[model samples]
Target: MAAGRSLPCDDEFLCAICLDVLCQPASTPCGHNYCKACITGYWDSRGLAHCPICKEVFAGRPQLQVNTKFRDMLEHFKSMRAAAAADEIPVGPGEVPCDICVGPKLKAQKTCLACLASYCEGHLEPHLRVAGLRKHKLSEPVSNLEDRVCGRHDKMLELFCEPDQVCICFMCLKDDHVAHQAVPLEQAHREKTAELRAATSGLKMMEKVKSSSVKDIKGSMQRSKVESDSDVSSINAFFSALAASLKCRQAELIQAIQEKQEAAEAEAAGRVAVLEQEVAGLRRRRSKMEQLLQTKDHLRLLRRWPSLQMPAHSEDLFAPEPERLSDNGPQFYAGIVRDAVARMEKAVNNEMELLFHEVRLSGSCEALKHATAAEDPIEDLIFRSMPKPEEHLRMIQRQHAVDVRMSKCDFSPGFVVSEDGTRLSFLEDVRFCLPEVPNGESQPPVVLATEGYSSGRFYYEVQVRGLDNFWVGVVNPAVSKKGRWILASYMNSWGCFDASHLKKLSLKRKPEKVGVFVDCDTREVCFYDVDAKTLIYSIAGCRFNGESLVDFFTRLMTSDDSNHRPKLYPVFSIFGSHSSSELVITPVSPGP
Candidate 1:
């Protein structure tokens, strides 16, 4: 039998049940061998049985024996395989063969100290027995032999230091390390042996921890990749759906625009066809009439009688009737052609006009007229006199009052209600006072006053006979009329009322009830209602004083005060300085 091959044994040595190897040898009466306890157990359990291998009858349990020879053979083979594997420098299971030494050689036995090269036993003879290489030390093959180097310089290391637990060169000990502790290579080897044993005790624990960490990191990366892929898929799906919807909307818009354009074109074409048809009919009728006039009968009559009797002028011939070829002979063709052309032109103009209705030719014309009318005084005056829109006027007044109060009073400008609660401060210089009673002696006054002014226009109004009687005048600086009176107020401070304050009153008949008075002297202006003698309102800001009274009065009479009514004076004066005079009340007769 081949040394490596497994051979079949005789039936007496073979196991009967497995048919290949006998686990424990047993003998039967028939001289056949079976596994110990195999045939005996079969027969003993059943009380009667034939031999499993030879069919020999076995009425009782068979004897059994251990197969020591077969067990020894198996152990020997395993030992040989393990020895052979150990002898070889076994690389990693799937590692590629070294390119330099492509074939198997005797196991690497020696390494060059200088070149750091490994050599098999066959190649190591020169380094061992040769006279020049006899001093080189040889070592058993180690997987990490390449890592041994001088501890300090990291060069090829031959010497080991037990004291430092390191490998070193002789140069290291002789140099800066001369005084340090040192030991022989043999002592270093013994120390390394103990260290290796200690390291090996915890090797399995380190490997397990390293393996767990690697598995955890790999699992985390795999999960992250999966989540990233899922996110990409979701985003792609969303954009695809959005793009599809946008495409649908774009198609819808295109269809709508196409339909609208088609309708517009169709309408335009229809109008053009109608105009062309009318023109064509006119041309055909003109051609027919011209052909009739050129006939032989008509020409001979015209040649024979130069002064032929013409038709009398009638509405059909003279009036501007619809142009037809027969009415005025050849001359009527021109009119017919003109009328047709005019109608066509008008139709085209109407179509164009409808197409551009938003275009304002009148606005352009007005702009041009305004640009050219810059020097026109009347236009300027008209523009100036045009009443501001009510909303705009209110806004301007509000802003003006805020700006004035913020500038003058040094107090934050805001609206405030009067103490009496009858008026609101609409602006810094303007107030709105509502009438307390509709038919009372006096309408409410919207007062306008400035601080520290002694003599100026004290303009106000009084209600008399259901009309406003406006007055403007100035009183003495000391607030007493008996003192030297000064001209102060005018209706509007034009140049004519600069020197003297004048008082002039006017009855406005259009509203049937208002009277205005302008006083250049004392700078007082007031308004009154004709049916009542009570003051309605006043404004006192006129700076004029010592001006010609008559001229000031003329200008004040002509001044425009359409928007503002007079501010009223309170019946009772509440001055802390003087309390001597009693309030005076006088009734005046109503004017006719």
Candidate 2:
């Protein structure tokens, strides 16, 4: 072994205190070798001189002399090991470097718990070969080796205190944590690994659930696209049919005018032919009269004039009175055209409203317009304002009309109600810092008309022209405005927008004006589409059932009104967050 065989086996070229290939190796008086600074530091830090391994106390501090021969051997060993494993990768970011490597650190291969150091394959050779080091624990390379050491005891934390739920050194178990249940670090690691695996299993389950939800969402999207495409095609066909009808009607009108012109020309031609015949007769008579005048016979001229007769079917000539005929010609057709146009406009506007109603299913009015962009449409706003009388609504308006006015003090903040209570509008820029109303802290602004109905049938109309997320319902005056929000058409029913026991409804037309009629005797409420003359909805057998729940809450939030008669009042709700449209309580009038 070249006279250095004992060096590797006895670890003579290593430091006992620093536990690495010795730098400036020094010999102690006790026949041990250590790095010179390591020995001096050990003594200076302790203020005593002693062997760390053997614990042989000295009477006084001993001088540490450099072991030149041992240090030369260590340098030789280090250089030889470095040259042997020179092909290994150098340590890079995120990789633990060998603690004992002299120059650029090589990637660490193993860590030693006994030595508290990481080693590359070059420096790890002695640990593998030495019998004394074989018993030391070896692990995968890890950075921050000091974290595994106990802070207070300065020993390797090799155990876990179960009661304390912390990593502890063996000395800690013997001291402060002596009575605590303890487990070997490997056992605790195994248990923690099991827990991690369980958590991973739960995460995998959640991942699968999320994946399924994503798949469902994708399917819904596909179905919506299909439906949208179908609707677009249907709307295209409808407009094409409509345009065809208009074209056909145009042809009919033109043809009628052409026929009328042709007949009038024929009538004038007949009258002109008759007048020409009469002129030829008068010319012949004049020639005859001239000859008679030459014969000096006045009696003959008079006789000839008497024989001259008026043309047949001629109008009166003496006074020449103009015919008093009612000329039902082009003017008559003009009235017809005007009437046809009015009917066409009404029907077309109604169909256009149907498109907005389709938004609930399509989820977007803008998307629908884009989807049906193939038709160069009439401007959308023109159709939005069209309205005609509805039969049921008009009847209700005439027979059951009741005056409704909003209460200024009763309405929630962030809203402005008209002095007459006919108009309701929201504040656009600010959330109110005003006084609290009865509906304080309840989201959105609410307004209930001052008029309440407890008996008899009554109807009122609301002009919901530009409103969104608006609710026009009858609330029981007996309960707080919060309760008996009996009905609403809340923004296509998105997100908890529903009446109690509400079911989905499909409207063919979005009503611009709505009429709500209540019959207390029958216990029934009916909503009317004012323009379409259609019953939007009707809820029968309504029991306010308001009193049952109001008394259960704390007195601060409760109002004892269980025994009061449930008188329903008109309620207008505007979710100030989204709605900006104004509502109008319109005056109802009878249909002519």
- TM-score of every model versus the real structure: 0.25, 0.43
Tens digit of lDDT per residue, candidate 1, span 162-211? Answer: 45656677778886557767666677778778989889866766666556
TM-score of 1: 0.25
lDDT of 2 by residue, 295-354 (tens): 767676677766554456434434564453336688788898899889778656644544
Global lDDT of each candidate:
0.44, 0.71
Residue-level lDDT for 395 in candidate 2? 50
**Alpha-carbon lDDT of model 1:** 0.44
Pairs of residues at least 3 apart in sequence or in different chains that clash in candidate 2: none
